[model samples]
Target: MNNRTGAIESVAGNSNFAVNSALSFGYRWFDPERWGHWSFDLDFFGSYMGVGVSGFGMSDHENLGFLGMRGRVGYRVWHDRLEPFIGMIGGSVLANTASGGVDHGAVWGYWFSPTGGVRYYIPNTRWSISLDGFFRFIGGVNGLSGPGVTINEAPHAGLGGRWLYEPVGIVALGYRF
Candidate 1:
């Protein structure tokens, strides 16, 4: 069983509450009936993330948004009943915040993610459930974090993770058309 727990992000001793989520639309690229056991898909995705910090009687809140596209390759091993897939996602994110009555405009950064998941179609319905996991690889703290270089970058090799894993994954219910 896979699980995920939400937590705050810590950077250079500064920590803030961060919430991450995504919404996507996808289309199968190849004719499933003709492909026989393998399928390809293209997806357009968007994500939302909120970060908040409070200390010294001052509070700063931020809303981060992301948009991207993904390409997926999947294989059906059990009569189209069970499928396992992997995909690549590329996108950009906007980080906007307000601090002590001052507003900072949105900052942008590019990112790439490699994801894997398993899907199971319910008995005889078009509805399916999937458990997906991915590790986002941010190029660098290019914008969003101010002019200063990012103190902590992606591919963290800390005790907790090298790449963001479970408890950080997404589960979705989808319909095949």
Candidate 2:
């Protein structure tokens, strides 16, 4: 009887350990709890032409460039295997073009982008991938003139939505801490 009781206790202990380990890993990955509901995300991304013309229709505008730093603060709206989130982001786009022996200089613009997305947590694991899209309202391109040129000389302030990429998409890896 004594030996049987000891064996039962040992099995129970091992089962508890396995359960705890699984729970810890899940929390680290999914982070479904509401106690620490705030999350910060950092991402690097590139954009393709959602709109606009390039090079007199010779080619699509080269939209490949550093997308700059993007930071977002999100509250966990719903937490499950797939977590859906809403957040706000701000970043800049620096674009340069060279054509016909002349470097067209750089255009810098700031944007206020509101984002929403969902993260799919892998089954029984702490690894997850997310897809996010943002509608970016960019402004403040007030004084963009080409090299060796003046605003009056260019005859345009370069303001307005000179570049367009609606619903920018991003994929990211994240872990719960």
Using Cα atoms with residue i matched to residue i, what is each candidate's TM-score against the true structure?
0.69, 0.49
**Residue 115, candidate 1: alpha-carbon lDDT:** 86
Task: After the best TM-score superposition of candidate 2, give how far the Cα of residue 172 lies from its true spot, in angstroms.
Answer: 3.7
TM-score of 1: 0.69
Q: Which stretches of candidate 2 lie over 4 Å from their true place?
A: 1-60, 64-79, 98-103, 142-165, 173-177
Candidates' C-alpha lDDT = 0.68, 0.47
Write the residue-wise lDDT of candidate 1 on 35-127 in tens digits.
Answer: 888878898989887767766555667676778998889998887788899988878766576654345556665667788999887987889
The per-residue C-alpha lDDT of model 1 at residue 174 equals 88
Model 2 lDDT at residue 73: 56
Query: By lDDT, who's the top model here?
Result: 1
Rate residue 106 of model 2 by lDDT.
Answer: 59
C-alpha displacement of 132 in model 2, angstroms?
0.9
lDDT (Cα, 0-100) at 125 in candidate 1: 85
Ten consecutive residues with minimal summed lDDT in candidate 1? Answer: 1-10
Model 2 lDDT, full chain set: 0.47
